[model samples]
Target: MKKLLTLSAIAASFVAPAMAAEEVNVYSYRQPFLVEPMFNEFTKETGIKVNVKFAKKGLAEKLQQEGEYSPADVVLTTDISRLAELTDKDVVQAVDSEVINANVPAQYRDKENEWFALTLRTRNVYSSRDRVGKLGNDFDYIDLANAEYKGKICTRSGKHPYNVSLVSSMIAHHGEAETKEWLEGVKANLARKPQGNDRAQVKAISEGLCDLSLGNSYYLGKMVNDKEQKAWADAVYINFPNQNTTGTHVNVSGMAMAKYSPNKDNALKLMEFLTGDKAQQMYAEVNYEYPVKEGVKRSELVASWGDFKADKISLDEIAEYHGAAIKLLDEVKFDL
Candidate 1:
């Protein structure tokens, strides 16, 4: 009878594993396709399910409204500025995990450990293969504003978060006065008043509307996999800017632990797992993002773009200048 009771207790533990079996709630800016698979993998590994709330915008405000009673255990999104935004709002708590510290680099994580970068993507210049050709690879980001490239460039709205973050990095690297001049110059060089998404700019290049475009590297992967956009993807070659000076400008997709996590331990486990080998590999393969953790190979499609050294500037340093970046974009009337 003692033996039977012990077996029954063991089965009960399996069925009811305390908080470990409880679901972790995540409020994510990342789209479902990019994050759902990772959650599925995590559940399979630990039996701790992940439930996500997807939003294109306003999740930050929602978390703030919920306050300490927030069901959110995590915030998942791209860009260091968004990560910094969470820290500024006081909605995220510090994560003192040694596993995360070991897996994430000092440059890609918050100084206070409130957030950690999972992946990286470069802000590259894509030039038309038939028009700009091999010689375009020799240009720098600073060259985009030069008169030699006048009326030959296309770009998304400067107010867009992606461009705003890039401008922030420019401020970090070059300082206010020089960056201000550069922004005005880029605005002057626009062929169409900064009127589309990054992929739209690439499409413009392919359609002969522009010879060059400012865009992210992963879009090339997305476009290559897309039937209608494959022609646009095939029409260009990637250029890593600032290679002669600070290296290429890059940004991250990162996550933070919510301040009021109801499942702190399980959340920490999921966070650590994301920085580990398996999840890092999925980030590289599934998302076409460069893994923050060392030794993970990029997807074959990404690898074919050729390797380039990433800019070594601390992302937090760039994020510090985000407000100034937006202000300068307005000063130049960039989108207009």
Candidate 2:
């Protein structure tokens, strides 16, 4: 999710005032320089015109083969299982908008408003501050299936849709037979076979091979503005797991509308100007994320990675337990 926002910089076009007879095409699976400075400040405050296209996988089957002649009046994505796979393929469209319901948070949108959730990420615990210092945060996630952290955890593909939306919120807080015996004790706490891409499990715990991993707090603000991963994100410790019950399991970065949105009133005024407050503070200063609205401040490197409490279930009740969290990660082969 870093480096890939350039298709000639999304064919350069912001058109703030001079010639915008209203517009809003977007299809973004979020990348064009992390949402083109909030669609160039929502086309410099309502001159409309905001036509992005970026992709990182068939923009939902190209909006189901351009249905309704898809010039796409908004569709953007990122987890909540691609907004429940574009609402089980109906391809989005409900938006009632009380200014995006007073700036999102009906458990991060889409109880029928189709989809909204602008930003907020979490799937934390990256530890390893030189062999778990800072009291190693006593890192919970049910201690990655305790057995005293067997093999010392590390992950990536428990059918990744961000670890199957955190194993479908641990099957909406422990259900599928204790979430399949807690995903076979988190796949027997793997340190090796479950390879790469959560900053390669924080560069495999800054190269001691493993000491826990399962990232996505804006990839530690893209590895503190990476320069070859800033010493593997300064050898870890991002923590934030279940602050004593059901919290810390957030997810989102949404938007939806294109079920034939021939610019539905400029795509409902660009989804109520991206949930107001200056496009949620440029989605927290150019996408470090965590702005599901309410008082939007947090991107001074995601408020220095602090504060917790988020998992009150209902990401539409954990996207209805994502096919029983991908069939309990294929009955616990969890990236074997």
Candidate 3:
């Protein structure tokens, strides 16, 4: 993926000079299918050609390496940790557009405006329908440590960004010492060594490997739509943990402006467009992600899952404890 992104970026450079003057270059961690529709619509509306280089990882380092000569006008990424990485690495600059400010809530964006969230997803607990059934509203994330569920829980790697952010939120609410013990307790209850993606954990539940698992909310929507995965999706009921306490841990897919963007006007326009009604609506319909924009309606399938009260804690605060969360995961030997 790294080599491919590099070669694609280089290929983009040769083609860039011949492209229309009204163009913006995008370095996206988002998959092309998810973002292309919005980009196409943006071009249709503004006459600005959108050039994208998509990769799963290494975009931040690539931007830093390119320095002032980087053709990347904007960067798109999923997870607050990735958004924090861009700001921490100094590869992105603050976007002060009034349109973006109005579109995204303060809790979902950087305090200094370096990054802005476009969509929201929760870190949910999935309970096996035949065994555990839907968990009660009183259930909390900390409850994953309870002995009653021992030998019945499954999850992905603790170091994965989704779980790390959840652990970070735990640290935020419980302090590191308590959160470490919580991690230790949760590890003790694992159905097997932590492995696989969120959907894989759901599959494990379907196969009766575990009675409960941790996963992102959108994966349920995706699984429901997939022919082979629907049975996995059917085997469990998604429950938003910590409903009565801190609220469920929510993460975001977001965007930032490259520090040395050559086409500032077009880049800002794209950013603003992403926050507008059209793009927000597209995100909900195409990706099944909750739109960060307040007034936009969720997709019918997403809305069917019912509304959740997302953790009110600022994502910036959660990003602060990300390293601590990873350290806790290691300290607990969570995947061992």
Candidate 4:
């Protein structure tokens, strides 16, 4: 009886820790510097430890490979295509939260609640401060292709996800044929080959390599804050493209609950917290991203950039044209 009691106590010791341990696993494409503070705050508030596996790519494949045994409770990623890919691959599940629904606008979330955008960023045109003051109101995305601007613009590879999404938006606004033509024209305008990241293009403008470049709105803020890149940032005016027409193209960073989440309750709590004012505020201030939640104050620097109407096309609709966008880039030999 004594031996049996001892054995039972040993069993209980292992079981108790297993039951008492409260944690939620996360598979994230967002870098640690971007999300650690938010996760720490969440742990402080709820006592649920957040374990994250950060990766630049292949997170979707990892989740799929793990199947039902996957420990991932949530997924954090940027851009619509990745979110759409997760949905298409059936790795994430619908999260029907009143908090999330109230915090995010309908257009920023999946129609079926599979994913929700945490923040937004615009695809902006950065123009040389020395060469081009403020672009005219008529300066739309289509103007990038005008013969006058030929050999004056620079951009990253058209095959990149960011450019693909922009091309996708063009396809959404115009048809495939017109988007193809636009791609061809933009290719002709490249100051050199499409060869660098967004900031690289801005740096090129600073070096007088090009007068205009395609970049994200947040990159300007990032550059301005960095001592080295401040000059690059100051060298250009960030213009919201197509403001008078289709509005500037916007992209998002978002989160979703994994289909086989091991900690559903905690995962739900984390999701709600992220959409709340605190996390949303963090996103705005720390990353220079526009929060998805209404009334959340933007960073002073971001607000200083002034306001422009964002293209109201549904991201889902934009996502539908992704393949077509890629094909258009290839057909035009955009990177070549």
Q: Model 2: what TM-score?
A: 0.35
Name the top TM-score candidate: 4
> Where does candidate 1 stray beyond 4 Å?
1-21, 135-138
Whole-model Cα lDDT of every candidate shown, in order:
0.90, 0.82, 0.95, 0.93
Evaluate model 1: give its TM-score. Answer: 0.93
| Model 3 lDDT per residue over 17-84, tens place | 76746899999999999999999999999999999999999999999999999999999998999999
lDDT of 1 by residue, 187-221 (tens): 78888888878899999999999998989998999
Clashing pairs in 4: none
Candidate 2, which ten residues in sequence have the lowest lDDT sum?
11-20
Residue 176's lDDT within candidate 3 is 100
Which of candidates 3 and 4 is the stronger one according to TM-score? 4
* Residue 35 in candidate 3, Cα distance off native in Å: 0.8
Sort the predicted structures by TM-score, highest score first.
4, 3, 1, 2
Clashing residue pair totals per candidate (backbone < 3 A): 0, 0, 0, 0
Sort by lDDT, top down from the best = 3, 4, 1, 2
